[model samples]
Target: MEGLSEKLASKLHKYSVLPFEDMYGTVSPLDAFVFTNYIFFLIIAFVATLVFFVVAANKTALVPKGIGNLAETGVEFIRNLCVDSMGKEGVKFVPFIGTLFFFLLFANILGLIPGTLPATGTIGVTAAWAVMVFLLYNYIGIKKHGFIGYFKSFVPSGVREMGPLGKWGMGSFIFILEVLGHFLRPLTLAMRLFANTFAGGMILGIFGIFVVLGVKEISAIGLLSSGLSLVMLVIMYAFKLFVGVIQAYIFTLLTTAYIGGALHADEH
Candidate 1:
């Protein structure tokens, strides 16, 4: 352990760990968990959403206010999606879908904060969220279509009408494919967010390491480059913010698609 520490110390002239390593070490001060950084951001995201809505609701404006405008933007965005995807029936599920989108968007955006790890970077967090989305839509589908109807909807009856196999064969094939695809959606959704956030986090970590190493190793000349490295780190983080937003949007869009599928037995 001593030798390892020495080695890391020597390499500190050329490399550095991302910030807040000590805070998220082998055991966190908060709960002895291995991933304290993720917990921290999860709390922040939860609180941020709570605070935003609480304040937004506190003020009631006849025309429009700043917070009202912000709330309206989010509401309108989700409203448009819900209407387009699920039609009139979509209005009822707006709260569910809207909250899901905001929670994810807030969590993803939290990764851009200094000295903080993005919770979405962790596969566990992403997978849990993905699974929640999967279950909710499937529940919605089952509830609206009924068990027999929903199962039947999975098969492509239209194709059976045209072919020799008739309804039986085509329905079987489509049912199998659709079931597999449905099961796969959660995995894909989790992976997309996890991969993007992990990559962005890694990039930021690398730039931070460069800055620390340059400052330690190369005398005055290296010190100057350290400043440039810091700038690069900031730029990378800014770009990552955009990635977070896009991924969040994609996740919400896919979720809406899933819900819409559940709503329309014909589309299933």
Candidate 2:
């Protein structure tokens, strides 16, 4: 028994692992947590969105009752967003934009749930989604206008309309600035989502710790601390829900705008 225990300890000593780890940490996004719970939350968001939409579709009421009304409202909202941002041409991209919005909306709200991790809090997850939008707009641009024309579209119409000397000089300067700005969009989008989600999670976590610590003692100070922490936690959760929805709308809005700009560079 002594020999076996020693061998087991020796073998396990070579690897460091978190208690929550489900597999080797190297392959997972959080790495230290192995297969982080955020992946499960992502699936939950996806399934919830799918099931909700499916049920809403099947239960159409003449007066548009319950989830059906919500479903209709959601579609109409997206339709208006697309039309406003990219004109009628944007209507065709609604499904894609809507999917992205709902996934994010659900993921953000999921974090407020007692034990679920927000997938958007993970940098890798946000980066992946941001890259998706980046590729999508680029593809749409290229498809709508040939590859060369798409690159040319990056130069604003004002530049092209300028006198030859101004076009070659001031236009080139403006074009370079515009290209650099566009290049940073993906990085900025990913960071914006990740930072906000992570910050919200951190606030909840810190207050949770205070609540735990305060509840351990029977003193008035302890009770006061616990009460404060609990109150703040409730408030923060509500605020985070609002933030999540706003972030989702912003992401979807930006996506449609990007696609619109790509498809109709001069006009948009």
Candidate 3:
């Protein structure tokens, strides 16, 4: 374990295997305790939501106040996106989609903090999120169209009616492919966000590596390398900040689209 740590240290300064016995670190025999980061993120998300509502509701300002303005801006931004994607009925999904966006945004941005780790970068976290989305979208579809109807929705009728694309042969294959594609949506969605955030964290770790080595060596070459590393670090951080916001938006938008599709599966 010690040797492995040393090997990892060479490549990444502040990046050790997680749960590294620091104050912010945790360990558990059951493997459940270390997953506390999920709990932490959930608490943070809940608190943030509460704070937003408290300020918005209490102030009740027509002219708008500090946090109220900010909160309203966020709300309006998301509401518009939801409406654009899911139509006027999208209003109902706004709260759920907006909350999802804010939670992910906070989680991603928190990683830029010196000691905080990104929970979203973890596979377990992303997988759980994806599963929830998959279930919700499917549930919405099934509710809208009974179970048998939902399954039947995947089979294209217009193709059979037209008798194009080599008639029945190509049509059946197209339906199967379309069904598979629908099933893979959640996997792709979750993995894309997870992979992007995880890569950003790794890039930040690389920047920290040079800084750490420079501090340890305390020499001319070390200083030069560290200086260059610092420049790269800032650029990488800026990019990550931009990407965090974009990823959160993409996730939320795609989620709305999925829900919308489910709601209207019987349509085109």
Candidate 4:
């Protein structure tokens, strides 16, 4: 068990990232830029997403069918999510949010395939996405209400209304805390996606190892344990599929909420 644990620990990092040279056994100029397994899968996801949408667009009809229907259904889901989170203003963001949702959904699904890594399972990929979201909502807020006005919204209305001493004391402290929390949003978003997907992959890998080890043992007990592990792996794979969809929805939902909050900061 200890040896198995050690082996699992050593192999688990493969789910995160692997350099081009390690993967292909040849050095390339791209290696200097840190091209990796996750990045390769990320590009595949991006291209797949682009092709899906393009095909869907070309195949659209009054009564959508097949890929068109699936595309329409996905778009409607994202549109509703945005509207519910941000109201009418959210409609304008449907394109961005929808793309993000589908990309993540595809990435997660692709990772389920043998020999492919989940792009979002990597911290760099998730962090890049979260940073983009952070920059976007903040930019929207700044554009809607000038830079000064947008930042001033960080302080609670009640705090700003207090007496001079109260305003400078409690208000400043709250403002600082709020700012810190705001900055932490990207970190939370990145970590949440990376941890969930990466952990899911690791669990699957560990179970796979167990199945292999069980099969290698020559006893009847070995066969029974391998069968049990196989069943559990199937169950876990199904759960991971559900989790992938939920994570994509969650990330998109939070993004819309953040944008909505920025759009209506004065309301709070």
Among these predictions, the greatest TM-score belongs to 4
Q: How well is each residue in 53-132 modelled by candidate 1, as lDDT tens digits?
A: 77876664777689977887788899999989989998887888888888788888876776666778877778988999
Which TM-score value belongs to model 1? 0.81
| Residues 79-146, model 3: lDDT tens digits | 99888877888888878887788888877887668666666776666778887998999999999899
Ranking by TM-score: 4, 2, 3, 1
Better-scoring candidate (lDDT), 1 or 2: 2
lDDT of each: 0.77, 0.79, 0.75, 0.87
**Per-model root-mean-square deviation over C-alphas:** 5.2, 7.2, 3.9, 2.6
TM-score of each: 0.81, 0.83, 0.83, 0.92
Model 4 bad stretches (over 4 Å): 2-6, 24-32
Model 3 residue 63 lDDT? 94
- Relative to the true structure, candidate 2 reaches a TM of 0.83
Query: Model 3: which ten-residue window has the lowest total lDDT?
Result: 11-20
Q: After superposition, how far is residue 202 of candidate 1 from its true place, in Å?
A: 1.3
**Candidate 1, pairs of clashing residues:** none
The residue pairs found clashing in candidate 4 are: none
Candidate 2 structure quality by residue, lDDT tens digits, 160-181: 7889988889877877887788
**Candidate 4: C-alpha lDDT:** 0.87
